[model samples]
Target: MRQTSYFHTVIIGAGAAGMMCAARTGQGGKSVALLDHAVKIGEKIRISGGGRCNFTNRNLNGHDGSPYYVSQQPRFVRYALSRYTAQDFMHLLDKYGIAYHEKHKGQMFCDDSAQAVVEMLQNECRLGSVTWYTGCTVESLTALPIAPAGYEQARFGINTDQGLFYCRNLVIATGGLAVPAVGASPFGYEVAKQFGHHIIPPEAALVPLRFEKWAEQGFDTLSGIALPVRISTGSGKQAVVFDEDLLFRHKGLSGPAVLQISSYWQPGRHIMVNLVPDTDLAEVLCRDKVGKKIQLKTALKQLCPVLPERLIDFWLGREPFQAVAGQKWADIPNALLQQLGQSLNHWTVLPTGSDGHKKAEVTRGGVDVKEINPKTMQSKQCEGLYFIGEVMDVTGWLGGYNFQWAWASAVCAAEALRADEHI
Candidate 1:
């Protein structure tokens, strides 16, 4: 913990991945140092899932990697993915006697409070030989030369207000610039760039969609309305789709489906919604022939339970639905039926923008995976330089997949460092 010219491993973040990596490396008999600039560790996790902390996903177990992850070479995540999977993470929690519950969709969250998870992790690190440094803002990294033995031997030349501390190995676990309040900084990406790691464009993910100007009035009324729907994008390029609940916010749309699909979405594209999935609309119309005399508004309300009754009256009423609704029972206009069915089935809205990094649940892109060794979480381009956590482009779904990546990557790097001797 003293100001040293050098140490074995230098992990530069105190979030989930950094903590996991530090613990693993330290447990391997290597002197590992963890540094963070935040006042509190795991601030993001503390406030996650409405303060319960959606920790990890139970469905994933030792897979080669996941399609959900986006990286320059996504295939590289295999080693970490297998070494420390969702099952392994859950085991750790169980060992700690932490009470958690699976909140639909394999998301494990604390039953009591997010604070419990943070305490458990901090306890784990304490049990190890990890040197903890908090409230230390990393100014820059000056990597020292590596010895012939492959283990880091040079001073990291770390700069902070606390003092100058050095480490043989450097880890960029500084995370991404998502929620700056939790110390989300571009420092990670900047450090990677300094060390010559290719970085992908970064953006906000798992945030609410902003509404377009024209529909603001309609969307305003639907703020609290939420329904089970399949949200998707275009085809050819993989479309984002979720068979989950959708909330119509005053700003725009949100909820599980939007959050899930937001990762795959690109700006300026319409976010498509399947109001009634796996169902035929023509059949619905034919079945409703008996109620043909009913007003157009009443018919539409009957078809889509998600649509507000008031909206139904306004949109599908005599004048509004005239373009889609048939005239009478005998003459159920073919074109009108098809149009109404298609519109209801394939509803879409353009997102003016996202909630941005301020409210984003996670960052989308990061250090390009091609430059790092997926097996070891070490820099393939810059020896002794490693990246973990949101700093890597490998993002997960809205669930706890991201946290799992952090744990897995940390273990991978820790084991690799332990096996190698310091230069």
Candidate 2:
């Protein structure tokens, strides 16, 4: 006979979401267990933002009208997000006296270390009396018939290295398959599939895009170069853009702008980058061409002052550009100048692949949102089974949007679990 322990709720993946859910559900005067395979809790949070942790964004719902999130069911996130806004999290931080300061674009980071966040959350979980099981392997989970007696309809039986566990509600908050070194895994999707849920086929999101050998050469000399740029993917309603700082890497492009666009980018699709987004390249070139005998390189320096010198050299030696090289600014034809201006504003490139989950900040897709109740984050096909955080199809922008989703979605599930206890 297997020794068994019982809880009103059991949450797997004691990540940001799972821990938040445990705190809420347990604080509701219910017994909760938060389990994880790793020895440490909140490893992701510990390593985020270079340890300072971009906990949340202040511009979540600002008048700027910038889209801050992405999903197959884009509207699905509105419910939870509306209910628990970024301000709410800030209030929590304030309550704990955890000082934080906003960085660029409304991103908030701890004044001290990311560990402060982990400790704050841990204190919250402690308030709820949430039992924690770390460094434990869960062998399997099986749905059993309704409890015969004394059990609170404990429908799911979980087998783990620690012991047998049973709970009426099971929450899967295992997150997505990004940054595997920090313990990211596909276990959440596997669990969703084990039920009757349909997976959305996850891919690397907010990851660095890689180029082929040929394209890599163009940027290799430009590695470590960083500049503000505008990058976009898709077209029309499907189009998404990010005007943020971009960085050149040995592999390819990696930065806030490229990562933001990479979420919307699909394989075989070309990404358009505006190298001189804030500048009028056409006007600059025309100004340089007006009765000026300046050489191509000389004119380019004035036009692309912010761009790296090596990158400017690489572009000058390339196609269309090669045609104008060695010619004086005055000798370049108007049509050719216009072409060069267009290239500067709309440089296109095809990414062979991304840095994969190893380098991804978050997984792009997961459990399809259509199969989940956005308001409750519970599975439509299966009752008492909830999914939250990055495990869902919802993927936010590179900033603190993902962290906000983790908190909001977890709260949604926890509230629902609390309500189910009364039903």
TM-score for every candidate vs. truth? 0.91, 0.95
For model 2 the TM-score comes to 0.95
For residue 31, give model 2's deviation from the true position in Å: 0.1
Give per-residue CA lDDT, model 1, range 241-263, as digits (tens): 67988887777888988987787
Model 1 gets an lDDT of 0.77
Give the alpha-carbon lDDT of every model: 0.77, 0.86
Runs with alpha carbons beyond 4 Å of true place in candidate 1:
1-5, 145-152, 214-217, 306-311, 317-319, 322-332
Q: How does residue 123 of candidate 2 score in lDDT?
A: 93
lDDT of 2 by residue, 120-155 (tens): 889999999999999978999977777736666788
